[model samples]
Target: MEKFTLESQFQITGIGSASGLVYKENSLFIISDNGSFLYQFDIPYNKLTRIPLVKNAQENIPKKDKYDFESIALKGNKLHIFGSGSTAKREKEITYNLETAATEEKDLSKLYKKIKQTATLSDEDLNIEGAIFFNEKWHLFQRGNGANSKNGIAILNDNFDEKGTIEFILIELPKIKHIETSFTDAILVENKIYFLATAEDTTSTYADGEILGSIIGRIDTQTMKIDFTQKITDINKFEGLTLYNKTQDKMEFFLCEDKDSEVLETTIFKLTLDIKHN
Candidate 1:
């Protein structure tokens, strides 16, 4: 077993940091909910670059409200971005290449329609916000709608197609009565999975609150079951996570926080792990 501690923090100038992926050795590509801008930032050096939003993505979106990008996954050289549309009818998966800057879009609704026309039960109601690749498959987690919403994880294939069907793995909250908690992002380190989540208090609205609550869960790749779960109640809303492989015996976890503060700003924390085997 090992313990984790925060090593470093930095501010990011973007809002609704829905999804983020490591594009290069020390660079990250980030997307936000309020704008169609893609930002690239270099760690340590702290350089920032911005790219334009997709050309016609706004047309397919159904509402004038902001779309929260929930998850991000990488396969080979392509980056896959997913977000909860304003309506269920507008869910989308966008694929882009960092090397050549090529892009493509897949309308999830159309895929669901095709699967439904064939008489199959698709979990179309899932509002996916977190995604990670493990054991040659993709796992997606969604933030449910309303108080009674069920939080679950879905398994997808390499082509981003549903493996068979989405499995609803209900996340039981300890202090909170509602399952309005959103699993926003996840990362795979070695054979374990770590995820980030936020809980909405009863008196707090979606946008305003103490924003205090984060959970890290470990999944056994062999059985696809969560083996260990730990909750950290002091940290604010975390949007993305990445595992950095440094030395053979050293492992570090980076967490991106989504906050509107000026001084603390948007931050990335480096967690140094101290592992001890019994």
Candidate 2:
């Protein structure tokens, strides 16, 4: 197993509860789980631009009305944002066209129901926190933070049609202090899948609890098996990740933390992992 080390950490201000992250075109695209805006952080200028996800709402949406966007994935010229699906209000998906700045919304109730039935997941156990489109398939990670503690992945067709066939597979993540870790976010680089997970001391999918830190892991796409898992020494609960850069001997990823607070500040950390040689 290759080892990952923390090289540096950056504290990004004026953003709250960042749940999904993507880096492209020298800018960081972020979405908060509690807000109705998509934040764009310009890397060179260190400026933050708030793009409204909805036209009528200029301010952050209330907690009760928030869609709980938990995962964001960039596919070609489109950006896909997904809700956590832990509640009825969370069963929605927003797709934004990067090229045209056009947006489309869809109800995921039918799809979530099929996922629950196929995975045999109870209502409380169906929370998706991470997603990525790789190899023409959409891989969605179920957080498994509820009482059932069922962490798994759902593979769907690229179109993501609710009537299409959905495949579900369970994953047993490493435990931290006897508490099982659940998926938070994931990014795909080359043919490998890099994921973020955290051990939270709670069984409710809709509630927050003591975070026991986070872990980073890699999975081989061919065999669909985890190659290595490493626990981050930091106390931050990193929920979002994106590849910042890569080299022959190392890979750098940008990770963002959500402290489960309403404060308008977030921390972004630079994680470096050394590629092992035979």
Candidate 3:
């Protein structure tokens, strides 16, 4: 177990809201929810480069704010970025080439519609936010919409074939100050899983409500075991996370916050995990 702490926090300017995070080479590639540019940053995050994606085509990402990109998963050089399957059910996955910037769009509507029907999820609670690639399959996190407040994970193959699913047993999670959080993001390291549970003040599936901060936890997928959990009260609407440095005594991560256009803009910060928790 590790005692996590927020430290050395900083902000990245210009990217309105960060939705997904991934790393290639020494650059960190972050996706924005509001635009066509993929944000790239160096280790220190002092330098940033905006890489553009397809936006002009109507079939591509919508020009409106309706298309919400939530989380990203990496498989070799092919970066799989998924849209949060909100009420629209127009789920889209864009597989992009890291080196050449080539792109291919995947229509995940049918697959997601099937998942919703199988899970008995209503339109409001059908938002798929967090994602990762492990165990030769892609694991996607589903946020609990409305008062249901039950989160879930979906395991899919490369072609988005539904393999199996696991809904979070709330009693297994930490007794947080805000237990109403939706699973936002996650990362895997050496068989250890760290994830974000964010509590926002919204009442629907497609709106951004007041942020109630977030909690980071380490859990096992097999047994639904939580080794330890930390409630971070600082970062607002935290959406994306990535491992920046891992050491024998410490594991450092870069956390990006998706503050809405109202209060504070989008930003990235550093978080430290002291790998010793009682």
Candidate 4:
């Protein structure tokens, strides 16, 4: 399989670190796990703007680095922002009106309780960092640790409720300088499932992890197999990516990377894949 190339990159100003990105036409919506604001970035112009969370929600935002919004996805008229959930018992998701940005928070307390009691999640290493709407359901990825780590795909209904059992898959990735790459985000185009994974350095789960490298993996849903794998060498920690646009031979992807500091690195990428092999 052919890997993707980083066509160009730009240093995003204003916000420090962003954990998730959602694209709508030419506009990119980004959420910072370290801050309580959502940003709207105009890709072509490199323009940036921020929208604050509800005041009460802002006050309740955790001070820890990882205990914040981890991913963003759009479903019909609602834009959902997911929290990394400090622990299984604390998970939460927020839905915003796509047009007005009006928000409503739903604590995933009951859902997490249901999963944990079923032995689906073995340990605290299970963090829902990446998610995508696909096949009339939500595919959520758990960022598993290295050393025989098994990352799982949670199958949820359109309402963000788990249906049956979680799907298990091993991500094939060679450690870049020995850091275990973990799944960060996912993109689904038809029957193909693409995952955005990253390897970073952090002392604990609550700290800000310094990104070491990243990789993108393609999975074939029909055959339940891994089709291709691509490694990203230059980007730091890309916690999120979106399918901007595509044609027959090439596809455009936009990404946001966490700098482990204040500003993030926003990049535009074009990937070419040989369909014959798949």
- If the candidates were sorted by their lDDT against the true structure, best first, what order would they fall in? 2, 3, 4, 1
Q: Per-residue lDDT for 192-264 in model 4, tens only?
A: 8877788776534455556777887778888757777777654567777878767666666777776666434
Q: What would the per-residue lDDT of candidate 3 be over residues 1-278, giving only the tens digit for each residue?
A: 34667764556665777877886567778877666566677756478777655566221234344467788877888777888887563388887788788888888887787767766777667777788888887778887745555577776666675444433333234433554767888888888778887877776776667676788887776765777777886447778888888888888888887765533245667788787432
Question: Comparing candidate 1 with candidate 3, which one achieves the higher lDDT?
Answer: 3
- Reference-based TM-score, model 1: 0.77
Clash pairs (backbone) in predicted model 2? none
Worst 10 residues of 1 by lDDT: 56-65
lDDT (0 to 1) per candidate = 0.58, 0.87, 0.71, 0.67
Better of 1 and 4 by TM-score: 4
Lowest summed lDDT over 10 consecutive residues: which window, candidate 2? 55-64
- The candidate maximizing TM-score is 2
Q: What does candidate 1's lDDT look like per residue over 213-273, in tens digits?
A: 6655566666666665555545566667777654655566676666533231355666655
- Alpha carbon lDDT at 12, candidate 4: 64
Quote each prediction's TM-score: 0.77, 0.95, 0.86, 0.83
Candidate 4 or 1, higher lDDT? 4
Ranking by TM-score: 2, 3, 4, 1
lDDT of 2 by residue, 1-278 (tens): 56677754556677888898999988899999988778889888888988777767333567767789999999989889999888888998888888888889888888999999999988778999999997788999999889999989999987778899999988889998978999999989998989999999999988889888899998888988888888985477889999999999899999888877888887788898887461
